[model samples]
Target chain A: MTEADEENGPDSGHDEIRSLVKGAFRGQQEDRVDVLAGVQAKIYDRSGGKFFSDGWSTSRTPPISTYLVTSWVMLLILAALYCVLAPISGEPKRVPTYPAPVRVIPATQ
Target chain B: MMRGLSVTVTEADDERRFLRRLQARDEHAFNELVQLYEGRVYRLVLRILGKPDEAEDMAQDVFVAVFRSVDKFRGDSKLSTWIYKIAINLCKNRGRYWSRRPSEAAEDLGDVEEKGWLEEGPARTTAELSAPDQHVQGYQVEEIVRRCIQELGPDYRDVVVLRDVEELRYEEIVEITGLPEGTVKSRLHRGRALLKARVSRLLGEKIE
Candidate 1:
């Protein structure tokens, strides 16, 4: 036991128990069995062997179909907004353009 | 520092790859997962259940549940944490079932007594005993510690096992158990105190 263990009054036996527990569990291993095979068989049966291709993956990215549908929906919404705003706003008030000055009076006829 | 960062990145990538393979129903990835965690799961279940047969069954069940629900694993926590949660929950359910069945509970209790460690006389002085006798005494002490741990309440036992035996960090334990940190700390504190008192008595020492 260390001084620190002693200082913690209730921990006097902590080290002893910890060591004994570790020893008891150290050499312990699960009995040899093909757990993977068992699990795979179960999953296969549950999913009718379609699990390999059809089960959900952990990936969170949206599917291609979902992305395509979302993009189309957003485009439709933007088009609708433009239609609603265009007539109300009209075209930008056309700026009146001034013609360039002509110096035709310099002919000494 | 750079090496450590790279190691962390590699581990993260490996875990992501493993998850992908598991999701894809790759048998090899499943085998590797079992190889990596089966022993720890077995030991944790054994400590919780105190019966080898049941612990073995429980450990297998944990993996099955993990495989079934691999898609639900959102990477919110470490895979080990999720597995621990499954094991702990299964143990808790088994405990509850056992409690409702008096005959089985009695049998387990009887087994504890039949082990005869607690009934053994006071601890012999190690200095006075022969070498073989000293060894026997030590073994008895170990048995006593194991029994004492078994006798702790489920809440305390779970925290004690996770913290002391498994040596998980407080945050990880909280994630596995879904308990607040304060609750985990208090339970651990009380569990240690109780274990200390029991072991001290078993060893014929005065309790401070």
Candidate 2:
């Protein structure tokens, strides 16, 4: 294969690049340090215990049960509101008056 | 095919359980997560950033990001893919900052070779003999290529690193980068070409 075609393609079956890429990272300091503490500390400190709080607020996503309960509560409130206000609020209080005052023929037909 | 499907389902279920624990702030689960992906995360950032110290910091930030945004992940993709996405975004953000201060960018690493691709065999250049380990010629070439990859623009750099260095598939790259499959392929093609040309030039230089 031509040298140009070696690393020219995305999936080119050339070992040069595969090996060279591997070699590039040789002798680099490995990331073996346990940063779990740092990560946890950052999460706790940055958000002021909003996350990783080890308590009620620990969950980044509240459970689905929370949503269901909230919806049910809201529906109950709406139902109670409708029952209490339905009779008092309807058709916006019709004004007691007779029919419109009839006007004589003013058509310019 | 049936087996693969079953395996995928099992994997998904396992991830869901793990994600639950993580989202719930299970310290043990989170610690397990660090143990699981920290090496890959560190290596990826090291390839992208070209510095071990920076990679360490970036990897920590990546995990922190994953922890902070676990709820945002909708299980539309694999957890590892999501983590890769976060790591890449952090890398790009830091890359942009470095680009703003060009002096501290890849040029600071070493002489980035110009684009040169030839049909002939490449000569082993000084760039290939200047790595930390002079005993291994591959390491020297590796160092030069690493620097060249860093020298590439962020758009091309991420694609090249993902495809070539990380050896990720195009589909995973699309999911991680949020680019169209065609865009990812085209960028990979272009990125690989750039990398080849750069390596060609560096490998052609005489040992000084």
Candidate 3:
């Protein structure tokens, strides 16, 4: 170990590095591990290849025509929904207002 | 999308068996593969990225890429080497695209060391230092430890961190870095000297 340590260079600060590493390990930043696991999960979900699960290309369509047709159908459905639900009407809806004076009653005895 | 060819299970040797299963798109083998090197990959990425969240995302990206491209992984090298190549490439892209230069990286030495000493409240930062503390933190110490590492002319930094902090064997490092063994050893020696000088400066500051 000393030879290897000496080979690395002057032994001036070797102790510092050793202590720093020990401290860092003692910190045991599990958050780092969790974050890494999250990455694994994301990759696994995207490429893990479970039967009928999340992945890059879930449905492998054969041709451009199939994609085009699907696109058209989806567009039509979206257009229809927009037409029905959109606030395209020029006039705003009228909410009937009641007189405010009726609620302003005199202070109770 | 890469093909959905099923991974083949064979009664062959270890590498062959693993490779066969991986090539055939066996999710079980893939999971096992992930289990094997997830820690190393994550640690490598975290060291590069410095942020837990970003490292995690990058690590996953590396594995996902591996999963998709396993078919193309000719067993010309060790599986770990191949995986490291993919991981390093992914980390490089992430670091590049995210504009994460080593210059912008934070230094943890003082904070880590201080915490080790105090065993108390949150670590004190260089910014909040008193004049005495600032003087104690000499230019050479600052230059040698923090900036020297950051200024280590990118090539050295990667090799140094990979070899020292991550503790990869020389051959494994050479495989991943594509540097000659002699070059690797040379850089390690130089990098260690620089690091030692920096650490010495910090100690001197404390004594003063």
Q: What share of the true interface contacts does each candidate keep?
A: 0.22, 0.45, 0.10
In angstroms, give how far residue B22 of model 1 lies from its true place.
Answer: 1.3
How accurately is candidate 1 docked according to DockQ?
0.10
Q: Which ten residues in a row have the lowest lDDT in candidate 2 chain A?
A: A53-62
Candidate number achieving the greatest lDDT relative to the actual structure = 2
* The 10-residue segment with the lowest total lDDT in model 3 chain B: B1-10
Cα lDDT for residue A37, model 3?
A: 41
Cα lDDT for residue B105, candidate 2:
45
Model 2 segments beyond 4 Å from truth? A1-9, A13-15, A26-31, A50-109, B1-4, B106-136, B205-208
Q: Where does candidate 3 clash, by residue pair? A: B6-B24, B7-B24, B7-B25
* Candidate 3 vs. true structure, TM-score: 0.53
lDDT for each residue of candidate 1 in A1-109, tens digit (9 for 90 to 100): 3456446642345565555555444434434433444454556677787543332321222266877898999999999999999899986988889999876877677
Residue-wise C-alpha lDDT for candidate 1, range B1-208, written one tens digit per residue: 9999999989989899899988876755776788788878888888888777887778878888888888889878888999999999999998888878864542343454466554345443333346786657756665666667777888988998898778899899999999998778777777877876776766656334
lDDT of 2 at A29: 38
Query: What are the per-residue Cα lDDT tens digits for candidate 2 across B35-150?
Result: 79888888888888878788888888999898878878888888899999999999989977876784654344324333322223343333355554443455456667778788
Q: Per-residue lDDT of A1-109 in model 2, one digit per residue for the tens? A: 3455444744664356545655565544354655666677788899886656664333434467887999999999999999999988867867899999988998798
**Candidate 3: tens digits of C-alpha lDDT, residues B1-208:** 1233322222224787789998987656766777677777887666555566777777778877887788998887788888887887786676566565545456556664554433222222333345665534432233334344444544566666666566678788888888897777667666655655655444443310
